[model samples]
Target chain A: MPEAPRTGELAPELSLPDLQGRATSIRDLRGRPVLVTFLRHAG
Target chain B: MKVRDRWDRWEEIGAAAVFVVFDDPDLIRRTMLTDLDVGALPFDVLVDRSRGTYTRWGLTRASWSTIWLDPNVYKTYARLLRSGARLRSAGTDVLQLGGDFVLGPDGRVVLSRPQQRDDRPPVGELLRAARGSVEGGG
Candidate 1:
């Protein structure tokens, strides 16, 4: 199990393909916090 | 916003971004056209393939009981349960449901929640959490 993030600790860097299949990476989200949601099929 | 309002408010928060990893191709199409008008969500909405992100994060929960122990997972489970969400898989498959995650720019996970079986995180709470990070207070 990956360790839950602690206060002041670096977050897990993630880079996943978006719905459009564009490469999105946490490393690219430097100036701001990134809110990533894993959603189920709502269609 | 009303608790039951089905609007996406991620666009309002400063630097607050929203990314939904949908495993279902059909859901991806629907979400794109859903017309969530709550707030200006400035983020990427994406589909997750290969289930790589779920596995890497170890977000697969063992049961509803186990989820309650983890606030992140429980929050999402409660929302789904309330919304009557169904999964593509059956029999204790955690990765098959909706999940929420809060990540810092440096790649640190601040909060992660699975879509609840009942209700999801209130827009107020989600905005508040994102606000904290935006102001560097979280």
Candidate 2:
């Protein structure tokens, strides 16, 4: 298991494909606050 | 879609949300159009096909205790059902857990919410967390 981010720690980077197959990254969304939610599945 | 309801609030705080899913692009695309009724979602939905991000972020699978023994899962399901969420066949790893995280402008973790079971992070609570982290006025 990788280290879980604590409340004050730096978040891990995320760069992945969107539905359109465009690469999106957390860094690309810099300068603004971000809300990242992981969904279990498409249930 | 609670987030959809409070989308203006998210805009007010100049923040955006990213939804990470384990499902493939095709499945998510279909679900977005058919089930979600949104031809285009307001937020970005990133695909985590390899689940590398999941493992790196310390999210794990649900155990027997977390799934079967926990009453909250049933409650959550009931809540979703009450909210018009249907019981559909899961397309990905059903055992894997989900999580929520809020980050400040500096990219530091503000709120890391690792789900204990089937419980999901409420949109209101997440909005509050983002306001606290971003606008300095929760």
iRMSD for each candidate structure, in the order shown: 4.6, 1.3
Considering every candidate listed, which one attains the maximal TM-score? Answer: 2
Candidate 2 chain B, which ten residues in sequence have the lowest lDDT sum?
B30-39
DockQ of each: 0.50, 0.82
* Residue-wise C-alpha lDDT for candidate 2, range B1-138, written one tens digit per residue: 567788999999999889889887777766644756433677898889999998888999988676778887688789889989777776777788889999888888889998778777778888888888876632
Q: Please state every model's RMSD to the true fold in angstroms.
A: 6.2, 2.4
Predictions in order: lDDT: 0.55, 0.82
TM-score of chain B of each: 0.51, 0.83
TM-score of chain A of 2: 0.88
Candidate number 1, chain A TM-score: 0.64
